[model samples]
Target: MSADTQMLSEFVFIYTPLPTKEAAEEMAEALVAGRLAVCVNIYPGVTSVYEWKGAVQKEAEVVAFIKTTRKLAPDAIAAARLRHPYEVPAFLVLPIESGNEDYVAWARGQAKA
Candidate 1:
């Protein structure tokens, strides 16, 4: 990729799951309010199956996709963890490898490290 492409790729989408829609909304608002994320999209009615404490667990969850710049990712994660109710909240930071340049620029501008 060219330098320009790299510059445009300096963003990430953080995936975080919460037990309820309310929790997801709260986290989303907190991140946006704190300027850690440009926007957060919340999706409810997700069924998650995983292992915890040597037992399998299944539960419904709401997922949040947080959009922000790479520079603000760490801060966003920290803020999410502080407010997340889960003992070990699941956080997956997916790099924005490519996208509309305008959206990338706008998201980066909205996020503050």
Candidate 2:
């Protein structure tokens, strides 16, 4: 892997769906305050379609994009599980391969391993 890739491998984007914008905002605030995430961007008005309890369901939800280091991912996930209302909340983590150097550095600095 390249230097940038290696550097970014330590970073991740965690996507979590909440029942409401208020829930998303609350979780985001907690994650950031606890230093579990460098940043959390809440996107409201998201439509989610999935299978649950052996049935397909569609609902309006809010998605939170949580940015953090891989080292802190577990804590971030744990926090989400505790705060999320759904019995089976969506907690997906995506590896960040590369990004702007300044932003990456800032993120790394903000989210210490």
Report the lDDT of model 2 for residue 61: 92
User: Which prediction has the highest lDDT against the true structure?
Assistant: 2
RMSD of 1: 1.8
Any runs in candidate 1 off by more than 4 Å, and if so which?
A: 1-4, 7-9
Candidate 1 lDDT score relative to the true structure? 0.87
lDDT of 1 by residue, 1-113 (tens): 87467855677889999999988888899999999999999998899999999999999999999988888888999999998999999889998777777876687678774
Cα deviation of 40 in candidate 1 (Å)? 0.5
lDDT of 2: 0.88
Each model's lDDT comes to 0.87, 0.88
| Total clashes in model 2, counting residue pairs 3 or more apart in sequence or in different chains | 0
